[model samples]
Target: MSTDGRSASDSTTASALESASFVRLVTKADGDGLAASGLVARALAARGTPFQVTVGRTVATRTERAQATTGGDGDLTLVVGSTDATNATRLDTDDRPATLAAVDHVRDLGETPDLVLALAGLVAAGVEPGAGESEWLIETARERGLVERRPGVAIPTADPVDGLAHSTRVSAPWSGDVDATHETLSDAIGADLEAETDRADDADASGTTLEHTDHRALGSVVALDAVSAEAATAAAAESIQRVLKPYATPDAPFETVGGYADVLEATAQTEPGTGAALAMGHDAREPALAVWREYGRRAHNALEAASTGRYDGLFVVGIDDGPVEAVAALSTAFRSPEPLVLAVGAGEAALATREGTLPPLEGVARDLESVLEGTGDATDQGVTYDVTASGRRGYLQYDPAVDETTIIETVREYQ
Candidate 1:
């Protein structure tokens, strides 16, 4: 990118980079008053362009100011606050001189730009407009070689967490020996847990249910028919984890380029999980970020749904490896009241909850691990929730006719 107001890329990357869309930072006060950027932001997003807000000029937060002012390639910061000469002068830069309003550019073709909400927000913030202030403001900026028309900038794409990704999110990382675990869970939950593995994935209603990609093993279990609730939950968890953990792609370690663990580590909004493999590298980069975004987005959706009473709770898994990042969505009917979704990585037990963030406390994780080993119920402690499915018996029938969609659906129900 050049120092001139117009952003230009290197010769090798220009053409592809030109397709990247930048941001027009907006403020809450003036944001509701403007229309162009919201429309433009949607247009860009429809085509896969990424945009985010960074508070540059605001009276609200100190942290926001520090982060926004140092904005770079993809950000075009606009402060909708006080516009006294000193404030305005502080906002002046080669690319993003602060403006009291959003500038309207010719969306269709080459033409000059138009300024919107000129000094309106500034007045609201108590900056009195002088005689001929608006015109004079534009004139002085023009003299300083700054124009109201801002160009689109390029977004940074090589992060696991920033943009679109292709990696799949796996809810149950390993569903090992589906049958054995199914029988064990059946005895554990004391009810005939639904055999979710029937490969009924035929799109044309072929009814083929077996799928190799996603090993969605079992569905749900109930304590109603259980002879011994504690024993059932323990059996179910042991049987499932015993098979699933060893079945993971042993060739791809957690830190490997396309490994699910690596993607999780890179794109994670908070710190890495405590169970993160010690030998794994923290630096994991992919060419695109679609996978990470989808995973995080799904996780966020699951969290919000439970919190908002959209659903009582949810249990599911996601697994992705490059090529347009895979996503697993959960519907309302399949949610669980007490979800026990766990994230598995390299033989470690790391759980993330609203209260317990990633890299859960070692002692807490150990205690929960023990609880899962016993009856599946305990008090919530730190980040680990009480294990709800322990020693539970359920039935899962696996067959060869399963398809991708079916497998995904089964996994959600099982979790």
Candidate 2:
């Protein structure tokens, strides 16, 4: 039972998928692809996610990613061959690289998983991915087949096979042999699904198969832009609830009789991720999550098959989330070396820095290092700004104070 006097799994198993949490991506900059990176940062800004587009080898080791990809059009590339790129330990230390490269050379193209994994790695570092960046990463992750991406959730797993097994199963209905009929249909569907995975070169590669048998009716569900997973599951579960009558036995108490099998990325021989079993204690909750998981698996399988046994979408996923909106995210990155200027408020003041550049003048912060390198004076929007140097830092003293919160909020629509 739960603290709310309900089965704990009720929330886990019965609840339908609502909006899921995702991270706003952040990475150590290798001083390359500033234009592309700037574009991506700007894109985030347009969606209310301001980012500071700065350059440095913040990623513990540059060797972690084979080729670093900026968040923009594919033309930009950052190859890390510097002395700092010496460690293979960090890259191989996590399960990300291996899982992302599951199918040898065919899968890990364009550093797609690198970008996704970088964000995942940041979660352990106390940073959260903003809604805009999180959603983009999730959608891209799904498109690349590195993880299951659905409307509200995404999972980049170590094992695609175990990562993708989601099933909603039930007990045998005593009425007409629904269990028997379900098994027959399941077998047929499994075979067809397997056929979908038949590859040209890897004759040994098997087809994708349904995971369960017996009293389960696998409902085919599609993701609607506005509809949540919970809604879909609750709507789908109605058919099952009508089949079983009320029975109150402690050994086999009375309530909803189904749950979704845990979906994960595991090798064939291993079990799927934890808590994937079909059986659940009697309770009344939504079934949308399980359904969504199943659908996520289906989408991955479909993409995998279409990619000629290689998950090709990985390259395209990153690109689709790019360019225009990305340029907008650039405004958030204005960094004036020093805290630039300070905005005053009641008992508090917010410091504002130049993102990368201010509109129409998008240049890599470091590239224009000389601007903050020596003293300068400039005017725009009726305000003249003066800069003075402090060690490697620079200070901005501008006339007519700007509201920090208001400046941050107003600058978000840059794209």
Clashes of each: 60, 34
Candidate 2 is scored at a TM of: 0.18
- Kindly report which residue stretches of model 1 are placed more than 4 angstroms away from their true locations once superposed: 1-63, 66-168, 173-335, 338-415
Candidate 2 residues lying further than 4 Å off, grouped into runs, are: 1-133, 139-184, 187-196, 199-415
Most lDDT-accurate candidate? 1
Tens digit of lDDT per residue, candidate 1, span 1-415?
A: 1123322322212222224355433322121112222333333444565654332112222124423354455444332222222211122221231222222221221222222222222222112223232455345434544332221111112111121112222222111123333344445433323323222231111121212111222222211212133213332342222112111221222212123322432232222221111111223323113333444445433333332111123333322221111111111111222333322221122122221222223234344434334544323321221110111111111222222233223223423
Compared with the true structure, model 1 gives a TM-score of: 0.19
Looking at model 2, which ten-residue stretch has the lowest summed lDDT? 313-322
Backbone clashes in model 2: 34
Please list the Cα RMSD from the true structure of every candidate, rounded to 1 decimal place: 22.6, 24.3
TM-score of each: 0.19, 0.18
lDDT of 2 by residue, 193-246 (tens): 333431212322233322221112232211121123221223224323322221
